[model samples]
Target: MSGTLEEIAGSDHAALARWVEAAERPAIVRGIAADWPAVAAARAGDEAIAAYLSARDNGNPLTVLVGPPETGGRYFYTDDMRGVNFRSEKMPMAALVERLLALRGAADAPSLYAGSTPTPESVASFATENPLPVDTGVDPRIWVGNASRIAPHYDMAANIAVVVAGRRRFTLFPPAQIANLYVGPVERTIAGQPTSMVDPDHPDHARYPLYAEAERHKLVADLAPGDAIYMPPMWWHHVRSDGALNVLVNYWFGQRQDRFPFAALMLAMHSIRELPDSERGAWRTWFDHYVFGDGAVHAVDHLPPHAQGVLGPPSPQRDRMVIDYVVGFCRSGGSG
Candidate 1:
């Protein structure tokens, strides 16, 4: 019972807020966004959901990916790992809706997908119709397409993905399985983010035997319309859309720059990883004391506000200082 995500009834804003702050694992929030107009319209029919979105469409162009049937609707790197198998185009939300609606019955139509399209960019009033308990700072995005597959990836921000039409299946993995997951190139990516190289639907164990190790850490969730999942930041998730037409609305928040992982990672990579084995060992001790093993997550009672630059409390000024220090280091060859 302690290991599994709690299933709470309804979208209690107070309860959801607490979960966003303290819940350490993924949660299956049943009926959280069920009352959203878009979800309700979707319950009526596929056309209803499409029409609901189109009515509020802002006419913004979102990036859409088109993949041939040979790829089996899976967007991934080419067989040679040199490039992706999909072509991308900037399409208007309303037109994309029409295209998806038209392809509902086409068995051989190329996979058409538009993911991470901002709600404000696609449909300005979409969030008003589908309210979330999260802060306004959280950016809500729309995903629409016929049946398609999204490769496994982790986001920098915490995510709450709500299913509007059709069904979605998610396979999740914790960050601890990064090594076993066989991540793809950081430079060449299918989308803007790095994705797992191993295919979960068809794992070639011989080529990537460690991927089987990742399987043990996998958590599966099958969501219907009105269902949403609370995914903590850095949790890897693989999503697959089912049925003829599918739509998902997701919100991403918790994008705190003060928490400071990326900047620290870049500095360490430039300065530490290339060091001699013995020198690298010394840096690990310093990292433990100052970075990863820091007890800052719990409390700042040990230090006064004045003593804490970035650790005591969060502030925009403190955030700027952290960034400036990192940037200055990079510009000055890390000495000044």
Candidate 2:
């Protein structure tokens, strides 16, 4: 909603690595996978692409999300938010392709989506034939579906996704806009990650007025076959796939934490959120000095390095100590 996303060229491994390292926002790389066999097959036609995928099917049945035509291909929560709008069904790649082809021209076709199927197991030779340009040491996952709108959500790891078929529009928001995005329940999620309650496409401003602030910082990228988009860690993105059949392969990498940040946030909420206002203010100051502040690393400088212990620089021993302490404290009912 703010402006068009930035575009960069080149698809070599080094160039891609550099672009990812330097990017603080989403960037579109046009024709990044132009030479891929999947892209060529897609350009030929839907049937050709479907056949290309069927030829590589390894007989593994992928879990597909099926929703009625009333949902308009949007996989989301029900009106009461107590249940999901879609049901999960398992079908082989060839069978799934047939179902999609059959519903190609139907105006009220049910949504059929097979998301995040491991490329190696689901489509045996696809990864080998169409390799990702970067070397993230992570295997790619494939998403095949009809027109669908995924709610805005953030991933724990950085991502690079390439479009193999159809068209995709990515609407991205910065991590700082989390407060304005009206995030939904963390424990109850349609997917593994918590998504924004407000729909970016058709926002209900009356119910979620703060979402208007998030729109000011939005960035959008419309990608065609062979185009790719790079997203940094924890960046909220809403994805919409257009056409009767769409396919995308994405790699997620660079997650280095043993415990997720959200887990820590939950713990903090349990311990500190309901405290008295004065006590909460005191805790905020302590947190600023010891955690979020730029000068936190030097806060322990007054003490000798040998005496710093857990407050010292990061190391395997310190990490082990912290993990053990936290585990012991939790197991002992916080008595430690």
Candidate lDDT (C-alpha), each: 0.82, 0.90
The true-versus-predicted C-alpha distance at residue 72 of model 1, in Å, is 1.4
Clash pairs, candidate 1, are none
**True-vs-predicted CA distance for residue 273, candidate 1, Å:** 1.4
lDDT per residue as tens, model 2, 167-283? 999999999999999999998899789999988889999999999999999999999999999998899999999988899999998888675588889999999999999999999
Give candidate 2's error at residue 252 in angstroms: 0.5
Per-residue lDDT of 13-52 in model 1, one digit per residue for the tens?
7777787798487877788777788888889887888788
Clashing pairs in 2: none
Q: Return the top candidate by lDDT.
A: 2
Candidate 2, residue 304: Cα displacement in angstroms equals 2.7
The C-alpha stretches of model 1 lying farther than 4 A from their native spots are 1-5, 134-136, 258-260, 294-321
TM-score of each: 0.89, 0.96
